[model samples]
Target: MNENMNTSTIRGPLDHEIRDQIISAATEHFSHYGYEKTTVSDLAKAIGFSKAYIYKFFESKQAIGAVICTNRLAMIMEIVDAAIAGAPTASEKLRCLFRSISEAGSDLFFHDRKLYDIAAVASRDQWPSAVAHQVRIRAIIQQILLDGRASGEFERKTPLDEATKAIFLIILPYVNPAQLQYNLDTAPEAAVHLPALILRSLAP
Candidate 1:
């Protein structure tokens, strides 16, 4: 049985159940087949729905694709929030979120071929939502830096915005397009070095 199917009916959250199935199937298809290769019909089949049912739920493939973006963003935010809760300092929180983002990449949506295809599409086409998500992440990092300054953990002279975004700028080129691309083994070292590197900007 496909994990993406629902047998129960007659409910509110259960209606949401079908939507979840659709998302799961679309994720697999996109990750496995890529944007151009994955079809609405395949998505419908994966969700155990008829073509008409898919149309009833989503106006088009693009609509479902947009939902994919929404789901991916939500997953990333959940990780960030959870990481921040466990972190003691703003700098640590920032590191936590970066690590969280990297970790979330390994989840079904990001690491899977169907899911990575969305990222590939965004990278290739320069999708606005993808760009927006990146901006928000950079902003979040900057906010952490500013807070660290308030606590005297970061240098007063550090340009938080630039330094925050620069972290990604530094890592972007060497990153592998496939998988989560975290130095999971080296992440603890990075967690330490990353904060220090940002704090360096504040040094006199």
Candidate 2:
């Protein structure tokens, strides 16, 4: 599905109540049955609606999956933001960000394996939700680097954009759903030690 396609162009009027009902039902269905196994027809049957009715709100099965994926990523960012807000310094905030991401990914993997599978597919398919989530994460990292440099806590010699990209790459294994499981065994140690190493390199 073309993620950029406007909903209004293809779908019916999005009545908030109806949309919520559909999304709520879909979430339960996806959580229990897994994304790939569930079809739009299955969702409609579960919600007591016709297949055509479901299509009025979502263009395709992937479209519905996109909404669920977006919500999950948003929740992760909220947790990350709260972690950053609680830390007193930019360096500490950066550390919190790293740790929070690793923790969040682990939580999803162990507690919500079905949803994690959806995220893995989204990441692998380059879905818009996954792409947008990565962009938001990088922006947060960039802001932290900017703050650190302003406070003389981090080196000013490195270009801000370069530094942000480097840090984002370092954290990608934990952040990318497709790559997360492979590194889970080492994530706990890396989450602690990697930030320390990055902080040392950034120190003024």
Candidate 3:
């Protein structure tokens, strides 16, 4: 075997287990070293695999970062959605969603700065997965508003499209990952107060 040959070509794309391992290793490197300083070769060495093997799974280090941020956002959304699923009223659902999202943000920002930093970069770079995650989050907020309108929890005549966008802007400070560090240190009270304002704005 030629030492110069691309090992990725010799070996097929990695299976699920190997792909997960690469993500796990990449997360560790990214967390400790930060994104710009972390390299594909670094992940390869840390995972006990050749650089080619890592490439066979991830297109680049940026892609790995994107996957990590996107997955984290998706999991948080799942938790938020699940928490609000059984709420008996639209008002309660909106409250649950806001509280759940606030809790998730605290976990990401206050407890895990490293992971939060990675997500901030992903959002700034406009990674496709990150963009998709934002769309899903917006839709979740929209659905809740629509439900509220139907149940007379919110003004029935309000336009949901505009309402959804407005709500996103109103809560942007608390929900945006890029703002997490600032909010955690200086504006902890906003987490509780902003959501209350949103709930009030939705009242019929």
Candidate 4:
């Protein structure tokens, strides 16, 4: 789990098609067996590849998990982006952002618990994919806020960076895999009320 290790250097140039094949098999393996319990050898066996062959594409099991985690998170972001794009106003977009994340997180927790476990590890370990995801979410929120201000739908006095950070903090529980299950019972209600409160706060 040395985050600083240059895994790419260890593997040298990869064959994209073979690398993708490994990733696809590893993702299915992790989804069924869960990330923590599965090893590279197990994945190789399931995929009919030698363990050494798998290592040529990925330096460690975590590297494969990182790719899977990134793809899973990207799916959620795609849903959120579509929701935001379909909304008619900034207020609605903000609400869509919150609701989309809440529903998506809940779906993963309930329907894909094994994958959720991988996300929990990624969040706890501060994986590069998880960190990058957070940055992207913050940027999305900042854009929504800027749009709101430009439309005169929101107050302009607050610093944009602070506002973006605060808004992200408010929604973090819904999105953070480590914290999500604890808040699941309240998520449906909070998803409705929280965005309403935020919109009111932003109103000019």
Candidate 5:
């Protein structure tokens, strides 16, 4: 049987299951065929639905791809959340999140190049959801900084928002998959020490 072929009903109400199948099919197709090459018709055929029906669920092929990228970002945030959970201090949580995000990006670069490629494209295209996810991530950093301030772990000579932006600017290479790879390739030693350097600079 074809992997994407759904035995369950795809007709009528278009429940969560069908919607998921559509996204899943779209993800597989995007990964294998690239976003520009994958069409709504292609996804509909994979999901055993009409092209019109596919649009009923997603606004466009790009929307589907953007959603997939957003989902991946959510997964990365989960890793960051896990790393922050047991950490003893805000500084430690920030450090843990940074290292975990780098590790996750490295793992994706090494093991799931296609997913990484999709994310890179999403970032390049500046899809709405992808852009929103980036904003959300920056907020997460801001909150971490706020926690650090509360604990007196980090000196905030600047405003929290300003500090957050500055930190994110410095650590962009570690958080961005494309830049992460470039840094790791061109300056392996700097790439390894970048997180710690940022933490120290932020310290009181």
Candidate 6:
């Protein structure tokens, strides 16, 4: 046994189970304590491991934070992907997009708020990946509209460029975290009205 091994990490096939356990424990710690208040020791105890045992799976607390953030983002992406996959029309895609943003106060996002805050503080002006994520989402929405155009399901009320921006507007605030914190109750309304607003703006 490597005594020098980090407590937050695990190895082998067992490591994955250990890894997920840490993430699960971290999620609860994060939600109640937020980023600053939560500690790796809290995580270890949550998993019934020693402080050093927790380090075995994670090199540092920051590494654990990274895992937490990525997991949450992946969850959000899954929801977004499913929405796009299930949509029969550009209009339906718009509704999913709206719902994505409106419901962003998810456990995943809430738990990883610390990581996001840290990133912004570390380099407020520099997030290439964040920019890229937005670009990809825009591309997906644009593709949906182009498909709508081909199917004659949409009237092409605006050029794709303008329409894409309009679509982004609907979901941007709700998922933004900062924006959604103001009022939690408006989410369902956001899910419904945003699509209607976009359709009104884009449909024949």
- Model 1 spans > 4 angstroms off: 1-21, 28-34, 45-53, 107-111, 158-160, 171-192
lDDT (10s digit) by residue, model 2, range 1-204: 445423543366666678778888988888889998988889899999999988878888888788888888888888999999999999999999999999998898898888888888899888878998899999999999989989989999998899999999999999999999899999999999999999999999
Tens-digit per-residue lDDT, 1-204, candidate 1: 011112221123435877677767877677667766767887777767898787756666765665676567667667777888889988678667656665565453435656656654554454554566666666777777777778877776546566766776643421222323444455445545665675565444
Identify the superior model by TM-score, candidate 3 or candidate 5.
3
Per-residue lDDT tens digits for candidate 3, residues 1-204, read: 112112333233445788888788877777777776777787788779999877777666776777688778888888888888978887777777667776787787766677778778766666665567678777878988888788777886667788889877766655677765566654456656766888787777
**lDDT of all the models against the reference?**
0.61, 0.88, 0.72, 0.88, 0.71, 0.62
User: TM-score for every candidate vs. truth?
Assistant: 0.67, 0.94, 0.84, 0.94, 0.80, 0.64
Poorest lDDT segment (10 consecutive residues) of candidate 6: 118-127
Better of 1 and 5 by TM-score: 5
Deviating ranges (above 4 Å) for candidate 6 = 1-17, 44-59, 104-136, 155-159
User: Candidate 4: misplaced stretches above 4 Å?
Assistant: 2-15
Candidate order (lDDT): 2, 4, 3, 5, 6, 1
lDDT of 5 by residue, 39-140 (tens): 678778877899987766666666566667778878887887888887988877777766777777777767766777767776666655556766876887
Q: State, as a TM-score between 0 and 1, how close model 3 is to the true structure.
A: 0.84
* Full-model lDDT, candidate 6: 0.62
Q: Report the lDDT tens digits of candidate 6 across residue range 57-175.
A: 67766566555554555566787888778877777877777776456544433555555453332122323333444676778778878887888778765777987777776665555
Give the per-residue lDDT of model 4 (tens digit) for 89-142. Answer: 899999999899999989988988898888888888888888888888899999
| Better TM-score candidate (1, 6) | 1
* Candidate 2 ranges beyond 4 A from true positions: 1-10
Evaluated at residue 154, the lDDT of candidate 4 is 94
lDDT of 6 at 21: 80
Candidate 5 residue runs with Cα over 4 Å from true position:
1-15, 184-192
| TM accuracy, model 2 | 0.94
